[model samples]
Target: MAPLRLSLACWDYDRVKAIEDGRVRPEGIELTFLNLRVEETFFRQLRYKEFDISELSLSSYVLTLNDPEPPFIALPVFPSRMFRHQSIYVNLKAGIHSPSDLAGRRVGTPEFQMTAPVWQRGILEDEYGLNYDSPQYFTGNVEPSTTERTEKVPLQLAETVKIQPIPKGKCLAQMLADGEIDALESATAPSTFGTHPDVGRLFPNAKEVEQDYFKRTGIFPIMHVIAVKRSVLRENPWVARSLTKAFASSLEYAYEAIHARGALRYILPWMQFHVEETQAALCSEGNDKWWQDGLTPQNIRTLDKFLEYSFKQGLAKKKWEVKELFAPGSLDAFVL
Candidate 1:
């Protein structure tokens, strides 16, 4: 077989796990890795067909699905992985404890159309009737494809809620600490915020929103997905299973490695600033960690929800039967 040609575009978070940890090595697969910011560059790449497979936001999937050309499909690589919390956090001094307190305060998130922000804002609007910022009025990147535009709503409400975008991961925490920004996207849950001294705790009312939102929608806003192009699947059908197997193996390796006595020592440096714990808590249960048990039907359902949302939100150009997103039995392969 000639060298299999493929490229993967992923977020900074997954890149560290796949590359630095030696999990998704490119040596045997003829894979070229692409690290991209999930921003305008993301849309530009899709428009130009620069990547064979790339990670995309659930919201982006929804927006792009509406487009007529360069038809793409989303595969369920890791679904509803709790990739991060994307919560609402305020500075201790801000005197804010609930979503309602956000009335006139500026809130910072990773992006304008990011899953976290959309979900958070949706909860505020749909439930609490809190009006979020207007498309142009907010501080974050307002990409038409990824974010929704609400028109004719009270401009006062939109202007009152400020949306500031922060860089991914640690930068999000650092900005909260330095007071460069107030509140966080809260992508990671408790254990993550506990790692930072400046962040006191998630907004007191966040749980209600999460629970109520999940109850009504049957899905949470996803942070990111390991998406692949439909064309790639045609050229390398077996690659999907190979990746599924490799990812399963990697998860097993990460789990055993973290649980093993001395393994924590090796993983510490690799996950240091990226994750908060010392060598002792490398594998402790919390935050957006990978699953050792591998993917499942529920995972697929979660991915499907995002794709469905993409279709409803006009992210995907056309609707796809779930099978179109995966190999014939990739779903079954992961389950067994």
Candidate 2:
């Protein structure tokens, strides 16, 4: 029998590099990995369903669950995860010295439903007494020269939630630096953050803050998941498990490369110290540390918390259990 051919749209993440380089092919599948940025992959997949598989935003993907016929199913294959403390940028004029001061402020974001913002809002609300509904939001591009970017999936915000697009020719980064927007929450750092003196990170001590949060909660937020077209899953049930295994293998490959301390694989001067810090913080539950792939209780709880965040923020109509988000065949692959 001929192998099933599949195309996957996602960024060139180090964890997924083995798959991209043809060193980790899914069983019974011939894969074509599309090296796309998260924004491009998300826009194409959510707008046009352009790929057989895609790296989908957790918030956007969960919102699609509200559709009568959800278009995609996922495995426990998370391609991107990050601690979002560094994602929040603020204007020096905003008078937001601490998280509590962000209440009733003007905030700009590329999209209200982007995963990083979702995580940031959730974390702020959960840990710092910042209400999810407090901010007045403006959506636009981060770079001043580009046109505003709208949500990939339209949002039906709660009556109390206030949000709108930034004015024409205005972008989030520039608006933030100019103090047109008091703060910005996004996955990508603004070009103005370092160059423009007015714009600075909300949490300047981000590494310390994020490390403390992880130690307290053990919740490393997942940004993107590997999703397959639901129609394709209906035809080839085994694809889910095959792809999951492939992704798991790819992560292991990444771990091996990162652990070769004798000769550093990356260019960082403190790569060894960084790896040791990560292991100390995240390795207690599993050998994979921050990149664990299976649907362990920890992983499921992380997904559940994110879904709760999406629903509470009015991005999803209702919260969904983690099992409902992935393929039936893939569910069993999750280790206890």
Candidate 3:
């Protein structure tokens, strides 16, 4: 039988570099990898089902689960995860010195349903006692925009919350710099902050804050998950395990490259130091596998918390079990 051929769309992350370079191949499969921006991939994949497999926003993915017939089902191979404390940006003049100060302030997000904003908002509300509906939320691009961006998924906002688009030709970054919006939360750093001195992160010592958060909550905030089109999965159910195995192997390759101390593969001079720091911060006392795959206890705990937040924030109609989020074949190891 001929090997299955599939198109896979995802960002150029180190963890998936082995798969991209053809060093790791899925069993009985040939892949054409589309290296693209995360937003473009998610938009195309979610809106058009443009690829056989693609990276999806966790928040957006949860929204789709509410649909009676979702077009995609995911594997547990998370391509992107990060601590979102640093995602919150604020104008120095906004009088928002702390997360609590965000209450009753105007906040902007690139998309209402984006994963980064959802994590940040959830953390703020849960840890700092900020009400979910306290802020007047604005949705749009982060740069000097030509037009406002719209939500990719419908939202059921709290009755106390008010959300509107930024005026045409306006954007979140420009609004924050001008004090039109008190703050903005996004996965990417706002472009205006690089040029404007007045714009600063809400948590200046974000690393320390994030480390504390992880220590307390044990969540590394999953941003994007790998999903296969339901039609493709239905035709070749074995493809799920094959793809998961390949991705897990690819992550091992990434670990080797990052931990190769003889010659640093990454650009940063302190790349090894950063890796060691990350391991120390996130790993158990004697274990260093901080980024393990395959729905481990830690990952499941994180996913459950995320689902709780998603449901509470109205991105998900109801709380979904972690097993329901991934293909059945992906939940356990297959004996060879």
Structural similarity to truth (TM-score) of each candidate: 0.58, 0.96, 0.97
Q: In terms of lDDT, which candidate is strongest?
A: 3
Candidate 1 per-residue lDDT over residues 164-228, each given as its tens digit: 33332335455555555556554444332566566665445545545455555444345555566
TM-score of 1: 0.58
Enumerate clash totals for all models, in the order shown. 19, 0, 0
Query: Model 3 Cα displacement at 43 (Å)?
Result: 1.0
Model 3 weakest 10-residue run by lDDT: 327-336
Query: lDDT value for candidate 2?
Result: 0.88
Comparing 1 and 3 by lDDT, which wins? 3
Q: Which ten residues in a row have the lowest lDDT in candidate 2?
A: 285-294
* Per-residue lDDT of candidate 3, residues 40-61 (tens digit): 8988887888999999999999
To one decimal, what is the Cα RMSD in angstroms of model 1 from the true structure?
8.6
- After superposition, the stretches of candidate 1 with alpha carbons farther than 4 Å from their true spots are 11-28, 34-44, 79-86, 91-95, 103-110, 123-137, 141-221, 266-297, 304-329
| TM match of model 2 to true structure | 0.96
